[model samples]
Target: MKGRETLSNRFEDGVLALLPRLRRFAIGLSRDRSDGDDLCQMTIERALSRRESYEPGTRLDSWMYRIMRNLWIDEQRARQRRSQTFASEEAGVSIGAVGGQEAAVEINDVDRALTSLPDDQREAVLLVMVEGYSYREAAEIVGCPVGTLNSRLVRGRDALLAKLGEVA
Candidate 1:
């Protein structure tokens, strides 16, 4: 019982310690603020419930990221399935009905730019660029080879620059 308590404490500590970074990564991945918050909540809940699967000596952040990525993918698939009944093609035009031009306009533009990226490219950029993970580490987190990850970084960067109007 004491050993289990120690492990539980460690898991909780791990979650708390990495929460900020995890939430940022979630935002980058989900692109929608609400969806990102929900994703982070779901990831934390899943990680705590599945604590036995965690290896004590491994990188907790990476493990947590893996959980988040998998959950995000699952959620996307579910959303796709449920949206089949509706015409998603038309829904893209319905921006959230925000009023006036404020600082949030820039933030929304950035989010839209990031979200427009392909899944692999977006994840690669988020890990390598946003989170400051190494190429090898980011590749491992995304379950891709280093070369593929590098390619994704280049593609993602180019796409982002084009979309965000950094390169005229």
Candidate 2:
């Protein structure tokens, strides 16, 4: 009982400490403040609820990030499915009219470019560029050899440059 209590306290402290970074990550994934807040809340709730699944001495932040990433992917899939039914209707809506239109357009362009990338390249860009992970850390997170990660980074950068051209 004492051991469990101590572990719980530590986990709570860790989660509290990581909240700001987690929120930032969620915001990057969601692109909406409300959605990001919800995602962060969901992540914290899930982490606390499943505390037993966490291995002590492991990288809690990485584990939490994986969970958050999976959740975001699932949410994106759900949104895709929902949008499919209204795709034609939504298609006519100009991206230009969105709130923060210019910024949204830029984000959309980046997202489209990102989606066009091969999976490994996209993942590498997201991990290193968006999330600020070091190359070695990203390689570990993506479960790839360092050389492979370097190759992906080079290819992805070239692809982005080609897509963005002089506009970026």
Candidate 3:
């Protein structure tokens, strides 16, 4: 079937095009690079395994994102159950290079502020700001009403501002 072949080729291309963005999203969701890579791999595997479920006319990126989000949530839950720990060691081996001191300090400060946020607020901010999802799309991805997402976003911003303090 030439049509089937064409459709499969298009789908494969679509998936490949989405990989880098998906990895970035996975990194935002995970605590470390290793976990991020694992999440991304799991997402790709799941998406490919369930390719038949994808509607031909629907948004493939959104569908794959939903799968990734669900997987990340599951991993978060498992980590919570295994140990309610927040230590850096619990985050698994670092998979990327650590930056210079100045960069590391900035990153640490941001990480501290981010980790201090409540989970819902963090997810809202990260999804909308870091991952560049629209409000409507982020609300859908997070399975929250738009108003709730707005509230979380506001709170998250305020909290970060407070933690970071005023800058010239």
Candidate 4:
């Protein structure tokens, strides 16, 4: 009983510590705040239900991110099949919602530029830049070769610079 209690507590702590990042990643993937919240909720539920599958020594953030990414992919496919018009909806929330300040507008511009990248490139950037994962770790999380991950980052960066101008 004590062992189970300790394990659960540790898992909860690890996941809770990552709540902000997880929510932001969820928003990045879904492009909609409501959907992002749903994804975050789903990730937490899955993690709790399958706590035993979590390896104690491994990076908890990576595992949780993998769960969120997989769920996002699945949701995308499901959405694609349901309506071809869904792409239009992916433009995401308005900039005003981020904040009324100028800095928020710049942040929104960056976010919009991020949305312009291809899905693979966006994922690579999210894991490497946003999540601050090492190259090898990001590659592992994205399930791609290191070279491929590098290419995606390069291309994604170039695209962002072009889309958001030199300020990016």
Candidate 5:
């Protein structure tokens, strides 16, 4: 009992430290601020409940990300089954470091481009480009081959560049 309690406490602390990154990933996955926030909360709750399943010495962030992604995928499937779709609110540009008006506009442009990518590509970009995960790590999280992940990133990056060019 004591061992479990100590593990839970440590897990909770680790989770607290990762909230920002987790929330950002959630928003990226869900494509809406409100839904992302809800997903983040659910992920935290799920992780806490299943803390015993977490392997010590593994990357906690990666584990949490996988949980969040799985939850998002499940939610997407449920929404599809119900034929329910929600309009995405504008991506919140202020989530990043805002230097000035120009920077804010650029950030908004990037966010729009990112959100416009296909789900697979968007996930790849967010995990690799935004979140700084290696290809192998991201592949494991998304449950795809490393080659597939690379292809998605290349396509996503190209699309983003083209979209930004049009804006420019």
Candidate 6:
């Protein structure tokens, strides 16, 4: 049907428009660019395949994020069952030249600080601080109460500041 085709085209466009944000979230979760790319691709594929289930006029970004988070959790469980560890620091080395050493170092330090947080805290920080999600939206994404999300954010923010020596 022409109507269905049009809707599909629109959905695809929406998904495409969200690719960069999704990729960034994936990379933040996986902590390796290669794995993050794979996760991002998987999320896009799954969203496209399941487009029929998506409700029109709802938050498409939220739907995509739920899919990504579910997939990441599944992969993590599988890896745990297989006794696979995360890649080493060397494995996370950036491929391209640094744009600026000072900025790069600061970014790396923040990333390192984030990685040091617990999984829940990291997710909280990523969704709120990094992705700019509202407390209610992020709480919904992570399937937690807004109060819990706020608590996690507070703890995560404090830990990051401590790790970065930003608290004098």
Better of 1 and 4 by lDDT: 1
RMSD of each: 14.4, 12.5, 13.9, 15.0, 15.0, 14.5
Ten residues in sequence with the least summed lDDT for candidate 3:
81-90
TM-score of candidate 1 against the unseen true structure: 0.50
- Regarding TM-score, does 3 or 6 come out ahead? 6
Error of model 2, residue 24, in angstroms? 0.7
Write the residue-wise lDDT of candidate 2 on 1-168 in tens digits: 999899999999999999999999999999999999999998998898989999999999998999899879867865765565344756768744666877887888888888999999999988877766668768978999988998998899899979977457
Candidate 1 ranges beyond 4 A from true positions: 87-168
lDDT of 4 by residue, 26-127 (tens): 998888999999999999998888889999989999999999998887677556644643334445455245556877879889998998799999998887
How many clashes in each structure?
A: 0, 0, 0, 0, 0, 0
Please write out the lDDT profile of model 3 over residues 35-144, one tens digit for every residue. 89999999999988889999998999999999999988866755664463333673556523555686777778888999999999999999877766668768978998
Clashes of 4: 0
- Give each model a TM-score: 0.50, 0.51, 0.49, 0.49, 0.48, 0.50
Please identify model 3 stretches exceeding 4 Å from their true place.
84-168
List the global CA lDDT of all models: 0.87, 0.86, 0.85, 0.85, 0.89, 0.89
Off by over 4 Å in 5: 1-3, 84-168
Cα lDDT for residue 123, candidate 3:
96
For residues 1-168, could you state the per-residue lDDT of candidate 5 as single tens digits? 999788778889999999999999999988899999999999999998888899988999999999999889867765763443332344344444457789889889999999999999999999888766669778978999999999999999999999999999
Give lDDT tens digits, candidate 1, residues 46-70. Answer: 9988888998999999999999999
Best TM-score among the predictions, by candidate number: 2
User: What clash pairs does model 2 have?
Assistant: none
Mark the 10 consecutive residues where model 2 has the least summed lDDT.
81-90
Question: lDDT (0-100) at residue 18 of candidate 3?
Answer: 97
